[model samples]
Target chain A: MTEKNCREEIIFAGFGGQGVILLGKLMATAAMKAGYEVTYIPSYGAEVRGGTANCSVIIDNEPIASPLVTEPDTLIVMNQASFDKFVPKIKPRGLLVMNTSLIETPPDRDDIEVMGVAADEIAHQLKSPRSANMIALGVYLKKRGLLTPQQVAESLPYVLAKRHHDMLDVNTRALMHGG
Target chain B: MSEKILITGNEALAEAAIRAGLEAYFGYPITPQNEITEYMARRMPEEGRVFVQSESELAAINMVFGGAATGKRVMTSSSSPGISLMQEGISYLSGAELPAVVVNIMRGGPGLGNIAPSQSDYFQATRGGGHGDYRTIVLAPSTVQEMADLMFPAFDLADLYRIVVMVLGDGVLGQMMEPVLLEKKQTHRKLPAKDWALTGCAGRSQNIVKSLDLVVPRLEKRNLMLQEKYRRIEENEVMCEGHLLEDAEIVLVAYGIASRVVRTVVSRARKEQIKAGWIRPVTLWPFPSRQIAAAAERARLFLTVELSYGQMFDDVRIAVAGKAPVHFTGRAGGAIPTVEAVLDEVKKLMQPGKVAVER
Candidate 1:
């Protein structure tokens, strides 16, 4: 794990409505709650819903400078297109976490760490495909060690809508299952 | 110390305004800035404050004008196109010498541009986007924390100068979430007694709050008065931050989101043994000319990084006054310049043979 004060920039990219933005927000909120300066910027455009949507999240001990991540330290890709688009942009020796259910072929990058989780499969096992993002995030938190699973779970109430509160247990289970 | 909360810039601004005792909020929904209006709509009514979703930006700015004329802390927010629609009312507010805060979460420009972030509205914001010989105090906040913190000072400065104060930001700043410490509710020390406000004359002489001074001489006098107030604000209200400039050979000038990118560039440049510094303008209308000039005295080069195609570059050139070379690198229509690009520009400027002073 990197020392405190070092910046970690991550990109959570997928097709829209895959909870990419929500996952980024959740990670940012958890990092902030753990006393790290954090920034989360969502990719916004006319084609936001069904198009390729990605968000950049940066967490550091010092104040963050830029919210846009050009070469992220970690890339969490939930779809094949997101994997193909963002895989090449990850820093050498960075972490690449992909949803294996959607991305069958692994990236050919030997310089970085790769973690493949069947996030959608796990979410389906949990009877909620929408919880796939949580599963991927669980793998990210477990691998990166930048944030604790406890911190991410504690932040669920803040990021999730109030009406979805009943699904906190399911999401938590999905997160733990993937981790 | 207050607990740090994760929030977007628009949400922070709305929360800050509520804490600042915002009396009324009148705004139309616009992308990138719609969150501000939404947050206000949800919170303002609960506070028993006035929040009106005007049918159009024109109506919203006019509502702001009416609210501010009554001596209440009022605000309106919108993106580029919507802000353009409100310019006339802004000019009226300025001409009437009414204090108001307007937040422009700038998006891509020209006409009906995309919802991505851009600083193309720099000229419109700093140069009195509306017609008239009046200036609005502009504060460009780069961080979500500043987005919250500056609202209090923005309202105070607007009230103090009796001018429209703009909190100019971009869509990136508006949409990005960050940790911010919400300042405790403030009690202003000396709020000006708005004696000029038209609160209806019970026994005193009737007060009129009108921007129309049709007579040429009176209009000329009013313009001069407004100029004097602007001059005073220019003298007292210029705010900027200098980072790692004590022994810098090059200084990067930027504001809002661009400045945030410059910080990273400066740090990276320093790692490569380049003496790069940055001057971030917190208040844009006052322009921070003196700080840039002071930096020019020592730094061999000045680079202006913006989200516009050289809009603020003109100001940088004017401020440098040819004492040192002034260079520009930017992207318009919502493209954010990357750290590598800015660092490359810095390295190019640092080359011994590449330095050329702008005439």
Candidate 2:
């Protein structure tokens, strides 16, 4: 058999307001800046508030043909619902980035790599739990060389906007400190 | 290359359009597709690009028609029902041979259907839902990156063929989060001078752009020319993806969300040593009939998974051409089938003589 290619499909899922989409964007932008073709797709239910939100990102050196990641190499579950809905789809030897403050039970698979981070707690320590998304993004960057701190920081203004400029800086710091 | 950012399919498309240097976006609001409009509404005005939330889809598509006629890069998007409303305008755009991009985030249908993702618009998109004989360049995006990446190609095709190009996506595909490399914006392609384009001729003769050819011979010739354009599109624009099909006994044919779900199911089935492969069509209009036909000769059973009841299945049957048994499994009205549901169907369709460890 030919050597299996090592491309990463990362999924970030959580409840509304957890900034699931923002984290996915940060990862995609960082990966793209790293010279990898990236695709980011966000999925949400009907409910605008408190609804389930999940985003999938695929980073590869070759030209990525499809952006929809059916099978993920890593899963970052921030809520119970997010974990329950997508846990089964995680591939073998995949990474699990879970929010210990939210998801209590770890996944059942023993072959996979599991990392539980108290994102909310860390964010609270930073006086901004919402930056938990940024914390999770930092971990992703550390584990997978998808992006650099500088590249991700460049896209901060476009993502965080003027209203959240201070928050953006804080989140960037959180990423740096956490990763 | 720019840094990576996680983005919604809608936001990805919006940013991609900005990157692609799209000049105008005319659209209205609809579920599972609101982000596409919202992204434009928030960015277009600030970018000095045109963005209009028209009262209705019809007005929005017609506005796109006007903008495209001026050789400006234009786009408009809506959901299934709203897309139905825009069909008349689409037919006109096709008839006038104008170039533009139309995105349809499919949902439960026939009328004002539910907001959940559905592929009911497959037939409407592939078989010319609009009146008269016309074919739009239909691109089915299964991932958020493809959703963003295809914009440049979709726009280029529209400009190249002088026809309406469409990005057909279901709610799940549109709403899903995935990483996408937004290519840097390119310089806008200048439209070649068309004698018929409605440019005020600036010291030359007058120009008129219209589809109404009252003369029968002239109308017939125009339609014949359109038929030629469609033939070229079908011949050259076929795009698809094939996975683990060599030496497989069964091939699962699907697209968009269904294809994504089937891909996972195939992986799980392989763990049990059940060999199942898949053929995913990226361009729905130029259906991957050639790929399906080639695979059918080696595969015994053709299983089709879709959100709607037996729509894309028909295409599978036609492509397989009785070389194998074609089976279909679907759930409508926004019901997302689990991997178990798909695996169960796949096992049921395994040939009678074939043996496997019962789950």
Candidate 3:
């Protein structure tokens, strides 16, 4: 029973079709596989019908207090809408990773470190557009350096549905590319 | 099946019921808890058990009443409004002395409240919301794992007392996902057989299973017996988690999702050397009154935080009995009380000669 001290709050935001919830689940799954206490919560309401979809993932060495993330330590945005929505909520000196392929502009924040990646472009090259979420996740894993890309890739079989098993290779490749 | 998996609280709780040897599950679709019904629908049939998506909450709970009469593990889950609809059936279950697990994944209330997490039903749940001279065992889980973990004990306790055990949670607990180790399927406590069940009276005089005793004195006796059973449960099954209570002057009292937030507030208060501690009621009914009264002997003040408009405040006040001042801070209608807001209340009370205890 180690004292719960280290906690990282993250928000993954994107449009409804952008695999935002899956990305949060992947991070949460990887963290759980690494034996850290984790909680993943999607924005639950009418917003999930089609508009903006987002989720909060918290990884901590100890039990999490509140699963909701008010101020995220890391904000990963896949599109322009999410980028504009979640950028202001990042903690000072936090990490912001944006999908440059869809997000035409970067966050105008001086307090946080920003990483712009052509995540959708890379996924398109990999012939798996859905793996773009994996690309942004990989960037966070590589930059945040909390959990490795290999860890998240290894968790793919567990997080993804069985029908999507065919995309594991592309998702893995996308992760490595972002890393 | 034994390995830990990252899953939502509702999903984990549903699987846990399967692991707990659930014989039947009845539910209607409601936000924040529809996952349980969906999961149970697929898994229950797969497990060769009974699952029903009843036409409504009223139908679901009556289904539970029917299922529980024959002496098998039965359950139904719903959100706030749906649970309200099930109240009559729940009261019937209590009067009939049938063991049934009813889960209330609460949401903002008053009426048709939005699908956001809320503890507004604290009063409804702990008070045995339905009717009649009765109280149900209410278990409040603050984490996803706790949601799963408590399901086993919930069934065991329900049968042990022949009462309805309510697993009370809010939208937050139902929607969030966490890593949970699937246990209880491999471990089970041997419980007493349901001899009073309506399985059959084939070999003897037909055993009547009914809550209605038309005779006034017979009904009075049954009510008194139920009260005795409730007393015994209160004596034996009061479950609470006490943190930093020893030598603490300020005590925070909460349960369910609110308790999770209070934990952080307690930690923050402790870091500031305010001697703050917390009491989280795992069993909301069997209200942990004795434990609270024990803490009231030394604590300078008690602050009850809740998601409702201080429904639990009355309980805390009763337990404290004015030995220490009891105050309340809460929000309603999907507004979650943050750690900072609760910590602010703690600091206000810690000020010298500034404690104005709200009666």
Candidate 4:
């Protein structure tokens, strides 16, 4: 009872087609299923196809206030551009999850814990390049221990469209493998 | 208990409208609000309701006017520029005493501006955007859950008063997703009959609905009747929420997404022993002025935070009536105010001998 309920603010950023928004949505759905108050807001603009896309997600035991995350507790970047843009904004000693295959250089910060996962390489090995985001998500969940693999697996149908249900098995494998 | 699902604010509004037994949805696609039209297009036809993506915003609003004239639950949604374009038809609906709901997922304004969240439309939405003397019931939803919950009451209020109602939100609220337990389709609530509907005059006398009157006295009488109805609305339906106001020294007045930011500020300020409170106006038109006045009696100062350049600050000043010093902090042209920026403003306001006067 002495421990206050923790609030986790996360930002997922990548190229538009990298499924960054969907990754945030999946995390938000899983968080909601786990009985936490959650909010997900995606970066929207006219150049959504090839442009950079990001989303902020807040999962708290208490009711969430603002959906905008100015400084995030976790930074998940799939590309170098996103890393450069958002790495400075992470809270000190925060968790930084990056796609090592894309960002060759690591951040210079000594305070934060940086977890570099070869997400794209793993997805390529699995023959499912689109599942890179799932791999990254799996890494974040494992590091944070906010949600279990089973919880995310169960919430897949809620976030994924019906036509893409066939990919759930690969997504789950990628998630568990990354974890 | 109903099942909870993650839904964006725009999608929540569309789903709630369908559950509220919406008969028709007519709207053109616009940024931040296009999701509503897309959702309605997908679901309305499946549910055997009429859904149309009109050629333009002007045509869409007229379609709402036509559908509402037949006493059907009709609605249309848009962003700031699109809503501005629909003002003429909105005026007609208000003058004709037709019941309709218009959802404005407001974006940066004046012109096409940008497709970003903004509350700059405060004056436009609350003070009557269209011509002539008229008032529309404005409901400002701060959460995705409220985005769904308010639609039922919005449609109900419109029908009860025989006037147009607006659900005012911004792009941030429209795009953000949260868990919500949507109420079941409203079948139990009693709805007043649309006896003035322009149905065929088969067994009864013809019912004519028109806003134009050639005579001056008749127009004046219509204006006076509308004013009386607005007064009744103000008396019965002023809704707001006061948070941490019991022992507060500073009260922050905000609505919609800005209110959400203010809530965070209040919490952070409390930890630092700053007795900051917040008042969120749920209904912007009726404007819960009494609540603000009461808070002024207890609080030493008042502040207003908005996504616009002090648009809602005027209303806050009016409510405080110079009883307490009122300050304003805001961002316009599609920028959102950060927590640090707002907290800095609050800290400055708490400084000694720096008072704010009404603008």
Candidate 5:
């Protein structure tokens, strides 16, 4: 991480109510804490409710340019709509992490690596379905080996609102469960 | 304060303004900039400051005008359509010589443009956007970090000059989240006392802050004084950044979010052995003409990239002054100019006789 000027472009996408934004924010905060230059750009246009929600997170060793990412190096999709829309935009030989419980259709590309995590199922076992995004986030971080699940777990208190801190225990458990 | 925090550009600028001793915050709802007002609404009251979500953009600017006269730091923010509504008030702020901050997190324009980021406000911001012999100082921030970094000075420059200072950013710069050290400025301009401020006369003569002057001769003298201030600002307040410019043949010129992409273009072009550089105007009012003019002496060609169709391009052309060919590549209506588009333009201009500077 210190030697190479690595730039990873990841897009996390799901339905609006899926908390995909908080998922990206956790990754961004953890990456920032680990001393990487990062940017998290969320696209919430006029129709923010019940629409397809997406955020682009770029973590790099060097200062990032063009916060907008046209083609992502990694794609994390929670629902089938996101998978259908963003699966084509992933760079060749890139990685795809999708929530397998909801997405029945497999990816069309063979060049990219795909991993399906039962994020919703894992999160439901902990009685916190809302933390499904966290579980999916943990899977990506665990596979990447660059940042740890603990890094994101620790960032929860800082990122989540004070009123929502009660869910910390369940969210952390889901993150570790996915790992 | 030196520790970095991941924050959105809109919140960062609002926080920066709050840390800059902003006494009053006034705003109305608009996208790409809602975060600034939202953050201020949440935090300003907690910090024991004044925060007003005014009735409208007009009301917000009038609130700024009223707050500015009291010799305290005040600010208002809006997007393109809302900002257009506040132009008459902005002109009044300029005419009254009020030291206040205005943030325009611009979006696509000409009518109710989309909420997606656009630099179409370049002309509106730089040209003062209102009828009068006045121009507000405009600072264009290229990144979220710059959004914070420029806020401190935006207020400082406003107070130092007794003029309206606009923090001009597009929706991308406003909405994007990045790591930034939102720190307070330690030093400031050794400003003269606010004797002209309408702080209510106690031991001295009453100070009146207004744009109204019925007497023709007095109005002319006041206008002349304002023009003199503008001249001083041009001489002393012009700020710009040059990148890889030494001995470069092709100059890339942009401001705000457009410059962020153009920077990527220039750096990528460098890898391909293109002698490209960038002239980014941090202060757009004092349009960095001197810097662009200097680049023209050595560069064979110049390209002005923007979100609008050559708003800043006109300024770059004027600055180049026929010393070199100035070309433009841009998009309008919420469309952002990408890195590839700009590189293609650069390569096209690099060819022999695509166009040449007019003698």
Candidate 6:
């Protein structure tokens, strides 16, 4: 409704092939479908390995800039490496989400809002370890008040393409659980 | 043209390609550049255009090669290291004189560089990233609007020269957003059809499209033809934007995102009563030498700003052709220069008696 509907910067960082980039993209695509401008940029180079693969996604009611989020409003660190690499860069009063199973260090800083979700354990409980990224997304959405479960659910088809019809229910359920 | 809409540089380039009548896209995910591929992946199918999320950057460029061979509008994109992987395919495309567009949203380099805005690829892009005595028509867009506007001209240049066209930019340009007017779509331009296209030979002689001209003499002749084409491009396609150059004593030469920062510095300098201007080269190749030389004839000094260790400084020197003093100022590995930093250099350049920092 304003010049900038919701200018939110999010960083997704995890191990290689943890679907961190995919999850970031899902959020960006959903925000874009909600008539927002979105930019998604994935990690490049050796950082894609055990170091830490990260992607930056910006969703704004207005145009975005510099997808490399120097100071993200939301920081989702799925692994220890990511937490170590990105936690200090989170903006004051920004939202920080972590996979409790992987990240041992809690948010030591007082300026940021931190949420720890046993995303891996939840996914395992849901009988899909790969859906941890989705669980993390769900928590992020709930905590930030950026989108609803339905908007995220509506975005699954766009993100997953032809495979969506099969995994749609699971992902939506995951979002519902966290949302 | 449509009403102006704010979009990121990658989205602007994608829209420009669509306006240029791009028929096919094949790209792999890479940092500081995935949005271009993502945009094509989702939009192409809806437009009845072909889009492939190729297994790797290598595969994507080869797919571009296949599409270009058919005289179809085709494009591929990647970042620095991924573009490194695409070099073999690009060399083949260049050798075969195929028309295609390549977008490089560069990050830091020299081996899996971190995913931040960096211009370390200036040498790679300008020196022909691939092997062989070939070149790509490299157009560097400084803003989101130019990202949209330049692609059409790039595609046209590639088609006219029958060579690969590259949009050389970095994460700053790729990820930054600004207002851009989407150009109206027109029918694909009329050009000589490719007889060597692999579309089949039902009732005609077989046509072979190969860069492998094994015969030395034949290869020599082909290389000479390409050399002549590159010369023609240099002569005809030189483009650069000069700002506040009238009666300016000092000139800042820059391109892409760096140029935007310099533009700000120039405006601020004017307010400070300093006669400083800027030369923003839109085409990295065809180096805009004539424009720089023309500016050098009257300007007191030239300052080259970039995101690398002064790669464009070499070109600036060549453009100045030793007539005016040229100085280099830059930062590398995702480091962005501020207007204040550029202004500092401009102030020193105007002094004419300060120690020139050489790296």
Task: Sort every candidate by lDDT, greatest first.
Answer: 4, 1, 3, 5, 6, 2
Task: Give the per-residue lDDT digits (tens) of candidate 3, residues B209-231.
Answer: 77888999989999999999999
lDDT by residue (tens digit), candidate 4, A1-179: 11267799999999889888988999999988888889999888674666789999999988898888999999999998899999999999899999998998989899899999999999999999999999998898888888887789888888889999999999999888863
Question: Please, what is the whole-model Cα lDDT of each candidate in the order they appear?
Answer: 0.90, 0.81, 0.89, 0.91, 0.88, 0.83
> In model 1, which runs have C-alpha deviations exceeding 4 angstroms?
A1-5, A45-49, B185-189, B357-359
Return the DockQ of model 1. Answer: 0.77
| DockQ of every candidate | 0.77, 0.24, 0.71, 0.82, 0.71, 0.08
lDDT of 6 by residue, A41-103 (tens): 665544645566888887888644234467899899899988988999899989999999888
Which runs of model 4 end up more than 4 angstroms from their true locations?
A1-3, B185-190, B353-359
Q: How would the docking of model 3 be graded?
A: medium
* lDDT per residue (tens digit) for residues B69-151 in model 4: 99999999999999999999999999999999999999997799999999999999999899999999999999999999899
The candidate 2 chain A region of ten consecutive residues with least summed lDDT is A1-10
* TM-score for chain B in model 6: 0.95
Native contact fraction, candidates in order: 0.77, 0.36, 0.67, 0.77, 0.67, 0.05
Displacement of residue A33 (Cα, Å) in model 3 is 1.4
Worst 10 residues of 6 chain B by lDDT: B350-359
Model 6 has a DockQ score of 0.08
Candidate 3 residue spans exceeding 4 A from truth: A1-5, B185-190
Q: Which of the numbered candidates is closest to the native, going by highest lDDT?
A: 4
Candidate 1 lDDT over B1-359, as tens digits, reads: 57888888999999999988799999999998989999999999999999999999999999999999888999999999999999999999999999999999999988998898999998899999999888899999989998999998888888887899999999999988888889854546476778988788999998889899879999999999888988998998899899888999999999999998999999999999999999998999999999888888998888999998898999988998988888899998878999999999888889887747552
**DockQ: the better of candidates 3 and 6:** 3
lDDT of 4 at B64: 95
Better of 2 and 3 by DockQ: 3
lDDT of 2 at A140: 66
Q: TM-score of model 5's chain A, to 2 decimals?
A: 0.95
Model 2 lDDT tens row, B1-359? 66455667878877887777689999999988899998999899999989999999889999998998887889999999999999999999988999889999998876887888898888888887899999887888777777888787788788878988889988877776655568864535664554556666789887667888999999999999999988888898899999999977879878887787888788878887888999999898888898999998899788888888878888888888988878888888877666778888887777477653312
The order by descending DockQ is: 4, 1, 5, 3, 2, 6
Interface RMSD of 3: 1.1
